[model samples]
Target chain A: MRRFAALVRRDLRLSLRAGTDATTAVMFFVVTVALFPLAIGPESTVLARIAAGVIWVAALLASLLSLERLFANDYEDGGLDLLALSPLPLEAAALAKVAAHWLVTGVPLILAAPVLALLLDMPAGGFAVLMASLALGTPSLSLIGAAGAALTLGARRGGVLLSLLVLPLFVPVLIFGAGAIDAALHGVAARPHLLLLGGFLAAALPLAPIAAAAAIRQALS
Target chain B: MALPDRMAYLTVAMHRFANPARFQRIATAILPWSAGLTVLLLAAGLYLGLVASPADYQQGDTVRIMYIHVPSAWMALFIYANMALASAVGFVWRHPLADLFCRAVAPVGAGFTAVCLITGSLWGEPMWGTWWVWDARLTSVLILFFLYLGYIALVNAFDDPVRGLKAGAILVLVGVVNLPIIKFSVDWWNTLHQPASVSRLGRPALDPAMLTPLMVMAAAFMAYFVTLALLRTRAELLNRRIQVLQMARGAS
Candidate 1:
């Protein structure tokens, strides 16, 4: 457990010092959200109706930005070999890396969501659920994206391939995340959507790491 | 025989049969039969479906699309399940044939899925009054099409053939596990689709006349899959051999 925490902290420190993980994803989120108004016209009603969906999609794409590099830096430099040889199991190592990723990129995206939501004229009622659903959903995105990153470590066209591999898997999260906020905006209970989002996170937490670890091992081999 | 000798013999036998030589020979024998069955069943199914089967009272002749659409959808799901199961087998045993089967059958599965989607759209335009709807079943099947494309791309993306096979196997297993979750969540998110009306577990509510051709078409699709899979696996085996030869020549 100590080793796992250390891995997470180490990743967090490195990414923070580099200022890449958090900034890139957050900036992409902002740019993507900012495009909608220009593209769809500044009609507040149009933005209001699509606000939840647009925010969720941009967050999804933003989380995808830093994914391919998740394992690339370490794998290329022999760090992954040491991790595989460590006393800490590689699955736990994978989970720790994904946790750090969620903290840096995913949390920032969640934090920036409400600002974008407001810019799009989303109702105040949706603010809480937007953040709540992102909190639950974004970890799953990072975890699944990490698995795609590991799978594509040395593959050709890694970036495009990673998106294809990861985006389809992101469907449920997008559905429920947007659904939860849409529910709140319309005065419906968001409980069921939140619960489903939680369920997705719960499933992704254990399963994705194992998959990522397996892919990592295969890449290393 | 001594224990060690027997074990050695067993291993050799296992490998011999596991190798594609034996498989090729077997496939060679069965291909004609499978091809014949495919052709026969398809002709029979088309005749019965397009001619013998009565037009639906509500949908009229347009309902005949189900004869093609339903079976293609069934094959799409069926092929994915087979790939998933084979992927697990390959992952556990490192079975070369299982890996080959998954790779060989991917395009076939993807083709079936695409057909399913296209026919569904064609049917939807007539029945649902639109070429598309965000309906749950439609969405899940569309996702299945994407999954197929992803698998095929991943299989070829790696520089190393072995790594490509292994990674593809892992991905298909992951996808199969998520298939149910995606389906359920999509269903939960919104449901404006019809319930399963026919060809269900207890008794299909379908007309007896329609059932015959649908079953025949399904059998025909299965046979078509077997024939194509065998032929493709043979090609893959040959491709691997050619790669080995080219590398060996390079080394020389």
Candidate 2:
């Protein structure tokens, strides 16, 4: 348990020092959201309808761009080999890494989403749904992206390959995340989609780490 | 063995081919039979489906697309299930052939899935009045197709073939669990799409006439996949052996 926290803290500290990952994801999110208005000619209604999708897609992309860093740095520098030899279990190590990843990249994306939502003229009623959905959704992204990241550790063209592998898996989260906002926009119940999004997060939390650990183990082997 | 025990014997025969040399021999011997069966069954299915099968009063002759679309979709799901099961066998039994089966199965599965998706979209354009819908079934199947592509790509992505196979096997197992969820997501939700027909809990809602050719086409596709998978796996095994022999010669 102490090891897990130490690993998480260590990762957080490293990510903070590196700094570029979080900033790039948020900037990409902002730029992608900002581009829509230019591309679509400033029709607030048009923007409003697509706000949830655009935000979710950008968030998805932002999360993906930072994923290669999840295991690549550690694996390349022999840090992963030491981790494998540690007393800590591989699954726990994976969970800690994914948690740290989520904390740095995912949380910022969530924080930045409302601002982008506002820029896109998203309905006021949808704010809570947006926040709640991202809260539940992004961890799944981190975890799922961890598996892709681990699998692609030394592969060529891994960036494009990672997106192909991870994005399809992200569909359910995108569906329910955007569905929650769409529900709120229509003055209907957003709770169901939000709940399903939560369900996805819960299932992914345990499953993704185990899968990621296996892939990482394979990569190390 | 008695005549009634033939299938059990066949299963044993299939299992024996689980060995690479034996597999190569069996596949070589059966490849012609498989191709012959595929051609025969497909021809019969197409004839029965396209010409002999009656047009739907509601959908007209355009319903012929169902023959192709439904079978491909079934193969898509079945092929994934096969890959997942083979992956499990590889993971648990650590069978070399199981890994080979998974490696061989992915492309064929992806091809079938692509066919399913394309036919579905084409069918949808006329029926649903749109080429695409975010309908749960359609979306899930699209994701399933992507999963196959992902599995295929990941399997080949690694420089070390062993690493790629192991990683790809893990992915297949993960995806297997998602398949039922994907198939049922539409039925579970108040979605725009209709509920599952043949796979539903109660008696299948499809017409008897529609059911017949659909079953025949499904059988033909299964035969086609089996034939092709065997051939591919055999070729892969031979390729690996050749590489090992080449390396050994170079070492000497």
Model 1 C-alpha lDDT versus the unseen true structure: 0.90
| Number of clashing residue pairs, candidate 1 | 0
The residue-by-residue lDDT of candidate 1 on A70-110, one tens digit each, is 99999999999999999999999999999999999998888
Error of 2 at A67 (Å): 0.7
Off by over 4 Å in 1: B1-17, B181-190
lDDT of 1 at B168: 92
What shift in Å separates residue B65 of candidate 1 from its native position after superposition? 0.7
Clashing residue pairs, backbone N/CA/C < 3 A, model 1: none
Instruction: Quote model 1's TM-score for chain B.
Output: 0.90
Model 2 C-alpha lDDT versus the unseen true structure: 0.88
Which 10 consecutive positions of candidate 2 chain B have the poorest summed lDDT? B10-19
Q: Which stretches of candidate 2 lie above 4 Å from their native place? A: B1-17, B190-193, B200-203
What DockQ values do the models have? Answer: 0.81, 0.66
Model 2 in CAPRI terms: which quality?
medium
